[model samples]
Target: MTRKLNLLLATGLTSLMLLSPAFAENMLRVSYPEDPKSADAQMTTDFYTLPLNIFDRLVESETTGPGQSALVPGLAERWDVSDDGLTYTFHLRKDVKFHNGAVLTADDVVYTFDRMLNPATKALNTDILTFIAGAEERLDGKADSVSGLKALDDQTVQITLTKPYAAFLALLAAPGASIYNRAFTEAAGDQFGLTPETTNGTGPFILRDYTLNDSEMLEANDDYWRGRPKLDRLLIRVVSDPDTLRMLFESDEIDVFDMDFAPTQTPYFYGADQWKDHIVSGPRVGIYYYNINQLKKPFDDPRVRKAFQMSIDRQTILDKNFYGKGKLEDGVMPRGLRCYAPAEPIAYDPVKAKELLTEAGYPDGVEINLQQVSSWSSRWSDMNQIIQAQVAEAGFKAKIITTDEAAYLAARKAGDSDAYTQVWSADFNDPDNFFYTFFSETGSKTRGYNNNDPEVFAAIEKARGMTDPAERCKLYQDLTARIVDTDAAWVPLFSLDHSFVVQPRVKHFIVPWNGWSDMSYYNVEVE
Candidate 1:
């Protein structure tokens, strides 16, 4: 290590120790820009990286194979799907232990899913499990327990889905599908998982301390099912400013950080010769686009919505906000996924936008409010400014409104915004997350502007159940056209390429495309 880095690490950690006395020399320090929305694990919208460390999913993902992730044994030692594809029986691993020293059982897994699917819990991501039979009924209060979810024994669990879904296992890999200790959670009641005290899981790390929005600490689990984690503890410090991330990295205070590069700092990261080996970047299978409220007047007309789409030059916005670091697309799905195919890019024509507005009975053009989450770290606000200017040339009065994340989300959910900037991160890397999440009945209704077209919803559902790769890809391609061209549910924009920094001492740290993983940090060690 450089003499500079050594001295900085020693000094920074010395001060950290004063605050968190449990932090040992083997601890790994890092920074995040947001806080976990809920400790309940069910209600959180923000990905603060605590739940993935605190909870263990049924099937884990290892990035050893193709696509975003390949499923591997996690809490479940082995699992089987029925010949007809409706039933899934999992054999739990014996000797697995939760953080609180209780042995994990099938009942705990059953309890966790029941709690998540219950409408009373109001978990934000329960759509991941709506495929399980009786899920909707359970969520709708028609059933006390998911009829499809039954614990056959202490070490065996069976799940029956309403239909075949190829992505079901992949969905299980997300943190929302985690297995928890039943005894601990039930005793905690509605307060379960709201604090460090009420949470217990079968993960490699145990929650040691959390200071709300400021900082959180996780100590290594000695009895972790896979094995003991390498580091003694891991610290997640919330530093919202991208500039502060670089400052801390330069001072050697934080060993690792990801995707915190600001537009101005893009040069230092891509141009710097000294830190060449320290940087890692990849094209993520994700999409960022505009969510237009079709229920609104101007947007209610498909022509006006199409005009809004063509007015702003996506290429220019990519250049200005992200420095040409992202790939442009006309279709809603991104490029890197196995099933992706390119579509004709929407022409950047202000003249056509004006013509469309006139044809739609708005010769004087239309006025609409655009919404974006207020965050200096977000490029949406920056892009909205350019959009407002570009749309003005097309005879539209674009009023820009900025709000905190919560209010923005409420507006979107209430279908109150004419248009709002939205981003989609591939939870398990598939076109299903693209088409089904935003365009289908479940996905669309959740948004402020929803598409209730029965044909489109049925197509997405059918494609998800198809097993043949060729057939599935064809269905997805057709669905993509329905979304971007026919339905115009979302205005296609650019897919991001992200940058992650790992100091020379950090080992086995791989940044997944979606930016979060269950075992990635568990394997990381400070050399």
Candidate 2:
């Protein structure tokens, strides 16, 4: 009887061990090419905004659907929009606390916006705040305070807008509107945005450890306002080389990989009988193009700019570099977007280009230098080389200048380059951000290019001021046709398709239209 009892006990112990949960420090590792420059939520670059968007928000929800797109119960449970559509009254969630055990309140929200609008903070999205009644004046140092913003009580906050901006809800979704812990920012001094270690926000994860050009580690925030994250830990590794990233994915070193795979190479991993089940592809919300410096000589002439557009073989480039994974972009907006139009793009004609160059007084073949910043996925060095060869075929001697990523961005921002590649991802489901920024006189002009064309500017203004969605779409379509036909400031290249390879064990991974792969809903289920 004693022997039988011992045998039963041993059998029960073995069964319990087999059914036990995976406590081996569950971590979901992701690999990407670039490292984030800062954890500062307000940075305009996607590097900072991507992670910050996942970590914090004033309101969050999807667009292009029936759901309410804006100001939907993030830190604030509900909010009231005044009859005039100017004042926003927010009712804060009662039982919410920061990662550090401090209760979140209206004071924190007020502090976050005040600091964001402060000139000293140098927030990148200051322009977005212009909708606030006195935010523009305050940011310009013409006002004593942001009179449009006020805290009514510990649980209520009110914001006043100067006008009924159509993209206001989308703007709120941006990182510039994220609420930050006052204590953390004050204590970190100058190093606050550089890493997640010093920065604290009301999110589901906290930055535990990170090494530049190496890896980042995030641990779940048990005190998150919504609830604790399912995964105990998240790891992001920086693999600057795409080839290496692919190899790592094949070797199973990383669980997920993103980037368009070459057609020739796809069969090896994504064969019908092999990894087909793991590969996923979808449309992305991004525009890739070359910006022309309008301030530069020759290119300043619209005819010369139009001639340059006619010289490049966009289809060939897309086929070669993108592996036919993307479609040629004729305008700023891609197909499937609300405002997209099937307009005519400049055809490749060396003779016409030469004639235009001669007309611009560069008869002996214009000598121009082109600069392209290095990117991990695009292999920009190779792309520049091909572009050089193509442009030379059109009687133009082109020189390619390459720089490291950081220096390249600085030069582009300072308008120090004659021409450079640019990519813009939509912040919201609007065409205004797309066309306005690239062509508007006041928007980012890394290329030093400005339309100055009265008709073009008027069309953009009309679209911006229009509140009706159908009217806005029609105006934008007309604007896109004008820009493409005139070759106003850029050469629209191709719209890339986002690709991702995930491990079979991962579930509920969603790749949204914005190219944001939301990992919050992801969970691991062991086979």
Candidate 3:
């Protein structure tokens, strides 16, 4: 950071805290990639980072090691599951309270899930709650509430699933599953998460203030259940331009920028002495793959899909596309997960690819289109062009198309595109997130891919209910092989390690296995 910016921050710290005499201590400023779109946690997917820190969930994933997290209690102090594995009862903490001073209760938990499951609410990631008994019924508007969820008393919430699901706790730990104040939400109406004033959560920090397209400030909640935060205040500002973000970090205007810097920028930042000490790189639970749309003619045929999958040279792409910053992923799960069983990916063979295409009745090669984001920030467009050439080598005519991020997502979700580059981050620690999310009928809306095969569906469903670890392991492995090797539904790609640059003053911040470690409860002290 520059000397001028350092002096300015020191002066503003005192002036800003004048409004609240109690908050004139430690301050941490960060440069964020984009502004949050919504305040309601369940309405959006993983795009909103504030909700992860502002609103506490029933359970939270505590970072253990790089690319590793363990499920721990959050609002619910303790929980127990019945021997049948279908019933789960949570004991809520009586001492916890929302930022509004309302006591956290079992009723709030019930209300949160009910609101998310309501057909009218149009929650974005309600697929996580599909295992809860009567969830389907409630979502279908056949019932007003989820029959499986009940408040036994003021401090307890019991949930019964349709069957034994091992990852139920992990699913509850997701950000979208965080608890909120029902009274406050209803009062905020349609404008709940639009501004800081309308958002009330039960987390470590309070929404101090917000300035659209500029920055937002957060003050430590003095009455927080986890005690006061180490830092008195957190100032998050937007610096979307990569060059501008790099300059701010260099000028000492920002303390840390956790968002992944551009691929080219990452190497330069790591090698520079003034910035090298602040670098933190760790494995993340995310995969960037190409989603195939079977709604199209050639992609609809299993033979065509297999032919396309068999032709790709994954090694060259990983080394060239990502600059060797990630690991080769052959299956759904990454290298760190327990269910992970790595196998050699299919070798790239253009000759074999052509033979398969000929057998599939496309002897003269077929025309297919590829889609990607219009932005070059993440290098999605460049990756698309690279693959377009690689596939064209094996009797496939590939056309590269670009559109804005939102339009590209909408087109993919509508199954209107032939193929599109996509990314999926782990919501929990289970293999079910990979198998159920991408390949099962259970995740039809969430995946937006073609997965109507009956055998694959049976394998996924059977794996979900397998109580024995040995059996579950066997089934998960089988399902992974079917999806990646045999079925070739998705073109498996590389998994990346999130790279970040922190200021030297920042201390004791750990990275989460998932994207953006839970900064909510970290001991962030700025010198």
C-alpha TM-score for every candidate: 0.84, 0.78, 0.86
**Which lDDT tens digits does candidate 2 get at residues 1-527?**
22332353345332222112342135566765677766666664456433552356667544432111323567777788776667888888886776566777787877778777888878777776788888988788787678888879888989889866666666776656777767777787668757655767677777655567776656677777666767665667777776787777676666677654233455455555657788766667677787787767767787778777888887787778767667788787865455667667668897888898888888888877788665644556666777788877666788787677788767666666667766676665567778777776555364445556677777776676566778888888777777777655768888776667777766555555563433233233223
lDDT of 1 by residue, 1-527 (tens): 22332353445443455234233357788877776645555776557377778888889766653225567888898999998889999999998988888998899999999989888877788988899999999989999999999999999999999999988888898767878788998888787776677878888887766667776667788898788989877877777787888888777777776654344677676777767678766666677788888877788888888888889889998888877878887897786664888986788899998999999999998889988776644567777888899889898898987788888777666656558776776777667877877788867866766766799989888888887879999888887777777776679888877666777778877656563322247878887
Kindly list the per-residue Cα lDDT of model 3 for residues 91-122, writing each as its tens digit: 99987889989998898999889889999889
lDDT of 3 at 192: 81
Off by over 4 Å in 3: 1-25, 140-142, 259-264, 293-307, 355-366, 372-378, 401-416, 442-452, 516-521
Residue 485, model 1, lDDT: 75
lDDT of each: 0.77, 0.67, 0.77
Candidate 2, residue 480: Cα displacement in angstroms equals 0.7
Clash count of each predicted structure: 2, 0, 5
Once fitted onto the true fold, the runs of candidate 1 whose alpha carbons sit more than 4 angstroms away are: 1-15, 18-25, 35-40, 64-67, 118-124, 140-143, 194-197, 261-264, 294-307, 336-338, 350-369, 372-379, 392-416, 441-454, 487-489, 515-519
Clashing pairs in 1: 39-193, 415-448
RMSD vs true structure, all candidates: 5.0, 7.2, 4.6
Order of quality (TM-score) = 3, 1, 2
Question: Candidate 3 lDDT (Cα, whole model)?
Answer: 0.77
